[model samples]
Target: MTEQTNRPVPNPCVGVCALDENDLCIACQRSGIEIAEWGVYSDEEKREVWRKIHLREQGVLKE
Candidate 1:
């Protein structure tokens, strides 16, 4: 296992629970599928999602 797997990744849900027209959570910026699959994702995968969320928040990623 990778070092990332040794650490537990926290869920990004902010309890907003609303999706935008693009199907991404209004608060967490995760897609509907992403939210649904979050529990099954490995730590590395979750980290990747967090990275994407950060990029989205930084305006580096539009979608």
Candidate 2:
């Protein structure tokens, strides 16, 4: 496995779990599916989710 793949990615959950109308978490901004499957996701997959969350926070991506 690559370095990134071997490294652990932190979960984005802030313990304020609530879904918006778009089904995205109001706190972490992850989709319901992403949150549900997070435990099974590879480090790379988790990183990708974090990237999207960053984009959402920056207004660079939506949904």
Candidate 3:
């Protein structure tokens, strides 16, 4: 038998677009500032948030 590994998923845009001083998603609790600054952020940074936000939504990670 062979073992299997799980694949990564994409982000969930809940339409809860609201930014506090930190610019984090008010509903999903994602880093709003990070999202906004994505235009300037490197691919690695964007990837980091994508991974974190997904984990957060699935209750696998905490804010």
Best by TM-score: 2
Better of 1 and 2 by lDDT: 2
The lDDT, on a scale of 0 to 1, for candidate 2 is 0.92
| Local accuracy by lDDT, each model | 0.91, 0.92, 0.63
lDDT of 3 by residue, 1-59 (tens): 22221333334457778865655676756776665676775555656777787787687
Task: Give the candidate order by descending lDDT.
Answer: 2, 1, 3
Given candidate 2, what's the lDDT at residue 40? 98
Q: What TM-score do all the candidates reach, one by one?
A: 0.87, 0.87, 0.52
- The Cα RMSD in angstroms, rounded to one decimal, for candidate 1 relative to the true structure is 1.8
Candidate 1, position 41, lDDT = 93
Model 2: colliding residue pairs = none
Give the better candidate number (1 or 2) by TM-score. Answer: 2
The worst-scoring run of ten residues by lDDT in candidate 2 lies at: 1-10
At residue 14, candidate 1 shows an lDDT of: 88
Sorted on TM-score, best first, the list reads: 2, 1, 3
